[model samples]
Structures are given as structure tokens and as C-alpha cells.
Target: MARLGIVALLAAFGLILTATSSPAASTLRAAAAEKNIVIGTAVATGPLAGETAYRTTVAREFNSLTAENAMKWDTVEPSPNSFNWSGGDAVVNFAAANGQRVYGHTLVWHSQAPSWVQNLSAADLLPAMRNHITKVMQHYSTVDS
Candidate 1:
């Protein structure tokens, strides 16, 4: 299914490339700007930040960016009390630098959940989930500020 999506995207991009005079004239962001809807891509922070080709394509082709897995429960909160912001922060910082809007992939999910969450009783799940969300949002408050 994912491979089909990629193939379809490649086919669409090929059409766009053939229709335009140059690569710069065929940006998804530019087409989306005409329609007033944002065009975005899920990107890995490391490649988006460190690889020139990936960074350049993302900045030029899309107006918004989403972290592929950096914002997932397991990646952000691996243990009970500890939270890691580095991965998520890197994506946000890169998006800001490229003049792209940051889209949070998800706040919580059953998949990729930490062991602590999996062990929790049904009664305690809600509070723990709320706390996790609050902390994540608070950590990124300055983005909106």
C-alpha cells in the first residue's frame, strides 16, 4: 500500500515535471499556494537537517513538514518520567528555517506506546495520557508564542 502511494506520487511528479519548463517551476508548494491549501511531506529530521539534497527538495517543494516518527509516543517518551525533545525539536527547527509550517504527526497512539503505558490499568490511562500531552505541548509552547 505504501509502495503504491510512492509510485503514484512519482507518477504525478513526473507529469508535473514534464508540464513545467524547469524543476523550479514545478513545486508542489507553488501549485498548492494557488489553491490555498498547504502541500506537505513527512520527513525524517536527520535527513531534512543534514542532507543537502533532501533539505533543498523539502524546502522548495513543500510549505509544511511533519516528523515521520520523532513525535511518536515511544520516541518522545521512552520511560515513565523522562521525555526526549531533541528529535522533535530538530524537525521543528528545520521547518522554521525553511519557512515551512510544522504539523504535529500525532499526540498519542496505541501503537509505538511505551512499556509503562502498556502496563497501566484502564483507570489510570487517561490521566497518564493527559499528562504526556500536557508536557509535550508545554515543551513546545514557544513555537506558538
Candidate 2:
């Protein structure tokens, strides 16, 4: 009876070890890949850059990512003819490093639009929109879709 109890305990310990051994075995990315599906999430550049847990979860569980606020018009181009691509670039680079595809979020959304853009004249609005869209798209041309 003593030998049988030891064997049962050892088997239980083995099962626990196997269950906790590999995190990737239960990842959403792996499960999605099995079904020919792409799992993705919207990522904020702040947490992605600063938080190890956030970055690890994003990379481990998702096969694709979209910039949450990084790609917005207000964030990318806060002033007329001026651009800041750092946040957006960070997201794209992270995705690339993790073998994940990037989904471009938005070029011209009314919400979170810059004050300069909102104040543009009708004639100037179209040109400004075109310029913003063209520049953003060109910058991320190398990103995987």
C-alpha cells in the first residue's frame, strides 16, 4: 500500500509539471493558428513599451496587433506639417519582432483629431487629410498587414 501511494503521488506531480511546463501550448495565437484564424488585439504604446507583462501577453497571445492611440491623427500628427512617428513605429516594430501582423488603425477620425486639423478651412481640409493619410501610409509601408 505504501509503494502504491508513492507511485500515485509521483504521477500527480508529473501531471502538474506537464500542465505548467509550456505556456505557448495554451496561447490564443497557437489555438487560432490551428484553425486558420488570426487572433489580434489593440495595443497602447505606453504599456507595451513600459510594462513587461503587457508586452509578453501581447506577443504570446496575439498573432496581429493594431495601435490603439498611437496611429490616431492627433497622436501621429499633432500639428500641421509636423509628424511624430515614434509611438506608431514602436508598435510596428514590436509586431515585426514578434512575427505579428500590424493592422493600421485610422488616418482621419473625427474623435481625437488635432485642433489644427479641426480648425482647417473646407478647402484646406481635403489637402490636410490627404497629406496625413499619405504620410502615415508611406511611413508604415514596410509593415506586414
Candidate 3:
């Protein structure tokens, strides 16, 4: 009788472990989906392209992505009218491939603005900012947010 009780207890424990240890049960993306919430992380372009582990984690865990620095003004528009869309595009492409949404970080921030933007006179600042926003939005029109 004692032997049967021990076997039953062991089986119960095993069943509990199996229920909790499933990949879908443990993943943030899946949990968020259950609650209709969006879980996201900031992705750095360098590791995103170079590290398999980073990419795997991002794809497995998050439903949305925000570029760490790649979407910042300094990185995207280092020079006026000379945009570099590579870094931002990499993030968008990865998000699309993973069935994840892309969240645009910022188009205008005091900290990450390029030198030319920073040096713009008061009269020139608004137009430059407007232009920057227009161009960036047009480029990333496909992003979810």
C-alpha cells in the first residue's frame, strides 16, 4: 500500500512539472498574448545581427521591438538630407520576420539630435524638425507603432 502511495505521489509531481515547464506556458510572448498585452524589448542592432542567442531570445520572448539606438536621430540622420536607414531597417526587418511589431523610439530628442540639428538657428529649427519627422515617418510607414 505504501509503495502504491509513493508511486502515485511521484506521478503527480511529474504531471505538475510537465504542466508548468511547457515552452508556451513559460514564454513572455505567449503569456502576453493570453492577456492581450504587448511585451517588448529594446534591440541593439550590433548584437541583433551578430549574436544568435540574442536574436533567438528576442524572437521567442517578445511580441514587439524598439530599436535601442538605431532609431535615434543621431544614428539615422548623421548629416542633413543624408539619411542612413540601414540600422533602423535591420530592426524593422527582424521584427517583420518574427511576426513582431516595431515601435519607433523617437524622431526628435534633445540628447540624440545630430550636430546640424543642434546648431540650427531658432528660425531653422522648426522646419528642420518637421522635415526630419516627415522623412522618418515616411521611411518607417510599415512599422506598427
Candidate 4:
């Protein structure tokens, strides 16, 4: 109840601020009100091969899905020539077919990286990272971000 009250107060303050704010205040207010209603689904379970059965199962349950830990730089682009879009593509396609939305996991983050990526020189690293983003975004950008 207290949390709800605080949220309500914050929302009221946001409205007041909008009224006194710049000319783009209405656009900002509407944007703020537009919810990023993302439904998250983890690819931790089911078949070890790829996002086959599990992907469909997740899509069946939720309207929109933000695949958890399914998308990462390394797996998307392991070596210079290797790129794996199967898992991530599955989730995105699933979301699209089901009239849902998708969220790309990340652009820059550690932990889920390939060994080759870890050993990259800064010069090489930049292009490689950019490639990963392009590939993933190309796969998922069909649904207007």
C-alpha cells in the first residue's frame, strides 16, 4: 500500500512537472505512459540442442517475450566467421508470429562471452561487437523498436 502511494505521488509529480516543463512535455508524458510491457522467458530448460520445443512453449504462454540469457555477444558471434542466430531468431520469430514484442538481451556486457572475444584487441573488438549487434538487430528489427 505504501509503495502504491509512493508510486501514485511520483506519477502526480510527473504530471505537474510535465505541465511546467518544455514544449515536448506532452510527447514525453505520453511516452512515459506507454508501458514497455515485456514478458520475459528463459531458455534454461528443455532440449539442449536449441530453442525448438521450449521456444514454442514460451510463445504459447505469453504475448510478448524477452528471452532471458538467450541472446549474448559470444554465442551470436563466436569466432570471426561463426555466427549463431538460431536461438535468438526462434524467440523473435515466435514473438512476431504471436503478435508479441521482443527485446535484444544486450550490447555490452561480460560473463556470456566467447574466449576469442575475450582475447580480442581493441581495434578488432569494436568491429566484432558491432557485427554482433547488426546481425541480431537485423534478425529482430522487423517489429519496430
Candidate 5:
């Protein structure tokens, strides 16, 4: 019994020491709608017609709010052949405008990439990497509008 209490205290202490940011969206707001088992919709999305009405409620029975997914590095800059920002850019823009925080899914990962990326020569790889970073960051940096 005493050991269990000590473990719990240690866990709580670790949590306090870790840097934290604004709470997750789930904690800030309730799901826009309720849900059940089959289907659901985000609170952000209007209309609870069909399964969304039920599923969403169930999913949120214990939580609030939904999160937006903003990931598309490979699709955005596939193959080092071209750059595409439509997916991620639109997300960042929307979040910024709506006063929502946008969490980048990842800046770097060991897997999940287009075929061309894996075959790139060092010469081709280096410049492609730099260019992609510069463009993606630049696009978000000017989100003042």
C-alpha cells in the first residue's frame, strides 16, 4: 500500500516537471455534436444528421472537442520533383484564422515517403531537403492575413 502511494506521487511529480502547452482541444470544448457506435462528426463540422448524431455523442461522452490533422510532407513535396502545399497549407491557414493551435504532425520521420525520396543521390537529396523546409516554413510564416 505505501509503495503504491509512492509510485503515484512520483508519476505526478514527473507530470508537473514536464513543460506543457495549452490543453488539448478535447479538454477545451465539447464535441460539436454527440455520437454513438457506427459514425460520428466533429463538433467543428455542422449538422449531426445520420450516424454523426449518435456516434459523436458517444465518442465525446467523456471528452470535449475534436482535433484537426495537418500532415502531408510527402504529398506536399513528393519526389523532390515538385512542391505541394495545398493540404497542409489550407489546414495551417484555417487554424491560424480561427484562433486554433495547429500542431505539426512531424518535421522529420524515418519512414513514410515517396519512392523518389528513397532513391535520391546525396546531391539531389540535400538541396531538396533545404528547399522544402524553406518553402513550407515560409508559407506558414506569412500567415498574417
Candidate 6:
């Protein structure tokens, strides 16, 4: 009966995963409202812009959204002077349209960073970090408010 128990446990686990992953309209928002908590999820800008189902589900279910990768160091500012805001803008615009709040994923992290950041010396690191923050903040300032 040990083998049968394992199979039953796996089936129950699968059901739990499916139930948690399934999207429901205002489910998160409703739950959060009851407890005065905010529900949020990490998302990619491109998918929300391209996929109607994803955009609709995210906008309807969660009250807050965060860009999964668009705002990261490697993604937004790849090189020294080159900054890309296309993906970031998409996320911001979508959030605005859906009346959803946006939380900045992260500013500094070891992972998903470019080589320039990885190779920075002690003296240069602060300056680079400041510049990155300044530029990113400036770009999102209008949308943030």
C-alpha cells in the first residue's frame, strides 16, 4: 500500500498546484481587501503586451504588478550609455490602464546583471550605481506619479 499512498499524495499535490496557479477574477484583490493586504505578482512586459489572456488575467486578478525582468540592470540599461524603456513602458502603461499599482522589482542585484556591473571596482561601483538609479528613476518618474 506504500506505492498507492505515494500515487495518492502526488495526485493531491498536483491538484493543489493547479488550484493555486489558476487565475480567477478579483480573487487576489478580494482576498486582500478582506485583510487589508495587497496582492502582487511578477510579470514580463512583453507577454502582457502581446498576450490578451495574460494581460486580462493579471489586470483583473491582482491589484499590484511588478516587472519580472524589464526593469533589471541588464535589461533596462545594457551598456554604459544605452538605455531601453520599451519593455518597461509597456508594463507601466498596462498597469495604468488597468488601474493597478506598480512596485519596482529591484534596483541592485548580483543576478541578471551585465558584465560592466560585475567588473566594477570599489570606487567606480558607487558612481555606476548612482547613475543607474538616477536614470531609471528619471525615466519612470512621470509614470510613477
Give me the candidate number with maximum lDDT. 3
Question: How does model 6 score by TM-score?
Answer: 0.74
lDDT of 3 by residue, 54-126 (tens): 7887888789999988989999889987899999999999999999999997789999999887678999989
Full-model lDDT for every candidate: 0.77, 0.81, 0.82, 0.58, 0.45, 0.73
The lowest-lDDT stretch of 10 consecutive residues in candidate 6 is 1-10
Predicted candidate 4 versus true structure: per-residue lDDT over 80-104, tens digit per residue: 7587777777666666776766656
lDDT string, candidate 1, 27-63, tens digits: 6777778688777777776675677877777778788
Candidate 6 residues lying further than 4 Å off, grouped into runs, are 1-26, 142-145
Two-way TM-score contest, 1 vs 4, winner: 1
Report the C-alpha displacement of residue 75, candidate 2, in angstroms: 0.5
TM-score on alpha carbons, each prediction? 0.81, 0.81, 0.82, 0.57, 0.47, 0.74
Error of 4 at 47 (Å): 5.9
Q: Flag regions of model 2 displaced more than 4 Å.
A: 1-25
| Candidate 1, pairs of clashing residues | none
lDDT of 4 at 7: 43
Highest TM-score scorer:
3
The alpha-carbon lDDT assigned to residue 83 of candidate 4 equals 76
The segments of candidate 5 whose C-alpha lies over 4 angstroms from its true place after superposition are: 1-70, 142-145
When sorted by lDDT, best at the front, the candidate numbers are 3, 2, 1, 6, 4, 5
- lDDT by residue for model 2 over 1-145, one digit each (tens)? 3224334544554576577755534656776797889877788888889978778878887898888889899998999989999999999899989999999866888888898876778999999999999999899997655
Distance from true position, residue 22, model 2, in Å?
17
